[model samples]
Target chain A: MFVAWRDLRTAKGRFALMGTVIVLVTLLVGLLSGLTAGLARENVSGVTGLPADRLVFAEPPDGRSPSFSDSAVSEGQWRSWARRPGVVDAAPLGVRTTEAAAAPGSGGGTGGGAARVAVAAFGAEPGGRLAPGGLAPGRVVLSARAAEELGVRVGDRVRLGPGTAAVAAVEGDASHAHLPVVWTALQDWRRLPGAPGGATVIALTTGEGFTAAASEAADEALGTTALTVDEALAAIGSYQAENGSLQLMRGFLFAISALVVGAFFTVWTVQRAPEIAVLKALGASTGYLLRDALGQALLVLTAGTLAGTALAAGAGLLIGRSEVPFAVEPATVLVPAAVTVVLGAAGAALSVRRITAVDPLTALGSAR
Target chain B: MTLLLDDVTLTYEDGGGRLTALDRVRLDVPAGTVAAVVGPSGSGKSSLLAVAATLIAPDRGRVVVDGADTAALDRGARSRLRRERVGIVFQQPNLLPSLTAAEQVQLMAHLSGRPPAAARDRARELLAAVGLAGEADRRPHRLSGGQRQRVNIARALMNDPAVLLVDEPTSALDHERGAAVLDLLVGLTRERGTATVLVTHDREHLARADRVLTMRDGRLTGA
Candidate 1:
């Protein structure tokens, strides 16, 4: 690090330029990661938050995959799953996206008229693990965002899809397909207009005896597909496409960061080749020189990445308070920063390996 | 003897056949003596120095520096030998632009795994010896051509090696500066008891050498 530290100090302009580039790239990646996670939470939090091991959806047409908008599990299927060996419990879950408005004369108006909001209505058995407490036939539980949007509180009346129900509670911040979720009774959901004849999907809690083979057999006999909570997230209509696009963008940013660091180090190593040869001739081992160069690169990368991540965290904190759906968690901040530094260092390692090929004899007659 | 080259032969691959760079070269320089080798362009003077410095291995025969046979050493061992027992003064100053004059000298000690504090003191002493005490903190770009060459000399002597290989030390200097540099090299060689091999093109500086030799067509002879 002796020579490396001095080199960094001596070449301030060049290193600072590269450092700024790294900082900006890291910032972009951090923000994008936060946005990706935030948007995903909005798109599938309702499904992911369910306290079930697996979700069983009605099998679609021969070539199609299961979808929440298209799947409908009948009572017979739910009963069969509950009776199957290794299945601890199976509860029917209804999901529908519809408009909810503050009931007339309920004093729930946002400004002058009754407030209307788009919501994902989740129907589950009353008092079940999937439903909020106090849910009943004439009552509903609104997610925090849902309650805020409809200008309603507990005990306030709201009209959902041609029926009216009193708000029993406001719990959780869960959403589905970018719409806040409102929990209601399965019977109430069935009575709504355009409602499916049965539950949209069956939430299942399996015990230790639920092997993959057993689940596969059950799925085959019941004409349904079972998925873990994470896999079920793809069943949501908007999550797969939105998450995939954001992830692809994040992937590109990581690639760009590596390439940019590689390019900078490549030029730097080439420019320092003469010095490397001189050092080698002066009895400095190749290993020593390589360590010095890599140490220098790590220093720059760590400093730049930390700065960028701090900036992103600060920005996300402010943006999260608004309705931008930005998450500021360690996974979104520190993980991206670590990835940037590691990838950048890998790029730099490839560039600095050229040091091994430098001939110390060249320093014999070569002019500076 | 501090440095000995016995019937050393070196060659490089050409398109069809091999080009002989050093042919059956034999030389010896004991400690505390200065041996000057003056040669024309392409006379293999540089090749002779390279063989003695252990930068390149001879195809045939032996090179012994401070009683260690370089032919028996691997690349890593040879590098360690150079770090601990040999010092090379390049034709061009070749001082790293990032380091100050003192740091350049200190790098030699660092390569040998010496403590930084001790290296610093040694570097300071050597810089003062080379008459660059006031300019120790100045970088290569901030120093004059003569000062840079002086720093190069101080750097090579930092480890106090048994063998010192100097190449064209006065090539870029005028008469007065070149004489002063040569004088310093001679005084240091005697004071330190180092086996010195000075390769040069100018014959004017040969008078100060304890012995003078000449190279031509890959052969050495008395000047």
Candidate 2:
């Protein structure tokens, strides 16, 4: 990288221009990655955070893709799952979105006065691991966001359906389908409008003997789609369409970044043809030239990506502090940056291959 | 003889016909000898250098550098031989713009996979020999035409190649600088005990050559 380093130092303007492009592309990818993860978290964190490894949903009609809105796991199906071999636990988790309002005289609980906020109401067995405070009849555990929206705390009353339930406690900030979750008993959840009488899905904890074949056998018998937590993300209708578009955009960005970097290096190598010929005529091997060129590209890509990543991380931290959903994990930030560098290098490699074809005899000022 | 070109013939395809560049040329340069080849434009001076440097394989016959037959070597071996035993100073200064005068010489060591640190002392000595001691750190653009050409000359010697091939080294320099460059080439050839072949159009530098060969119409004749 000796010549590569000197080249960078001497030709600062050309590399700087290309470096700036890489930085901007990386920044765009980083921000989008964070937003995609954050939005995805808001859409499925409630279901994903469940204690079970799999969520068993009622199979969609006519073999179409399964969806949370369309699934309604009957009580019999969950009981059968609980009795199945290798099934450690099968907990019924009901989910639905409904209006939430503060109770009168209990922490801004004015009926007809306080705003009614839409919330995803999740119901599990009273002592289930998901909604911890034992969801009893006429009582509910409100997620922090749900409680904040309703202006109510513990021991306060919030309206669910026609009747209201006393808030047992404000627990985690679980959400689903972009709405904060309100945890209630199965009985109380039945009263909410548009909620099926049975549970929405059955959360299953499988033993070591569990396998995809066994899961499929059980699903076929019980008329359900048994999917792991990550796989179940596609069951969310909005999540599928929204994430697909964003992901397509991300893919295009990666491709564009690779091509852009490749094109830049192509022109750069062409412009340095004379110098390359001179080096070759002076006994520089093709491999040496390739390494020098690639090293320069790698250095530029790494510097640009790191700077962009740091900037993106700072932006994510700032955004995470606000109400906007933005994830800043390794998968969301570092992965994208790494992919950009790898793809950019691949592009640069393709461009610099032309260096190998340069005729060393050209340096003698004549053609053979 | 360290650099030998035996019955060498090279031709180029042009418009469904072949134009000979070097026609059955035979040359040999023993170590510590300076051989000058003088020719006009298109007179096959560069072609002879190209063949001797192993940049191009002759159509017929062989190039033996440092007693190793280049015809038996592969592409990779040819390049290695060039780096290890052959040095070519291009017609133009052709210094990489990014490198300083000293670094231009150091680049040869880099190409040969020798440590830059190991070559630095030698590079300094060579640069001083070419009168570029103070201008070692100055890049090509900052150096005058003569200085860059001198750097080129110094770079070619850094590898201690057995065969040194110089192509029109002073073509781009003024008469005084050209003469100085020619003198440096002749003096280095003898001091380094290298087999030297200098190709040029200028007749004035013929005095410095141990033997002068005039090339015309794809043939060489002793002068």
* CA-RMSD of model 1: 1.6
Candidate 2, B-chain TM:
0.97
lDDT of 2 by residue, A81-141 (tens): 9888889999988888889898777777775797889998888888766557747888998
Candidate 1 C-alpha error for residue A368, in Å? 17
The sequence of per-residue lDDT tens digits that candidate 1 reaches over residues B1-223 is: 9999999889888789898888888899999999999878888988898888888888998999999999889888898999889988888999999999999999998888899999999999999998999999999999999999999999999999999999999999889999999999999999999999999987887898999998888888872
lDDT score for candidate 1 against the true structure? 0.91
Global fold similarity of model 2 (TM-score): 0.97
lDDT of 1 by residue, A1-368 (tens): 98999999999999999999999999999999999999999998898899898999999899988899999999999999999889888999999988898887664754337867889999999988777898999999999999988888888889998789999999999999999999999999987767888899999999988888988999999999999988888888799999999999998999899999989999999999999988888888988999999999999999999999999999999999999999999899999999999999999999999999998888998211
Q: Give the Å error, residue A263, model 2.
A: 1.5
Compute DockQ for each candidate against the true complex. Answer: 0.60, 0.77
lDDT (C-alpha) at residue B17 in model 1: 88
Q: Against the true structure, whose TM-score is highest?
A: 1
Q: Report the C-alpha displacement of residue B207, candidate 2, in angstroms.
A: 2.8
Native contacts kept, each candidate:
0.63, 0.78
The deviation in Å at residue B123 for candidate 2 is 1.4
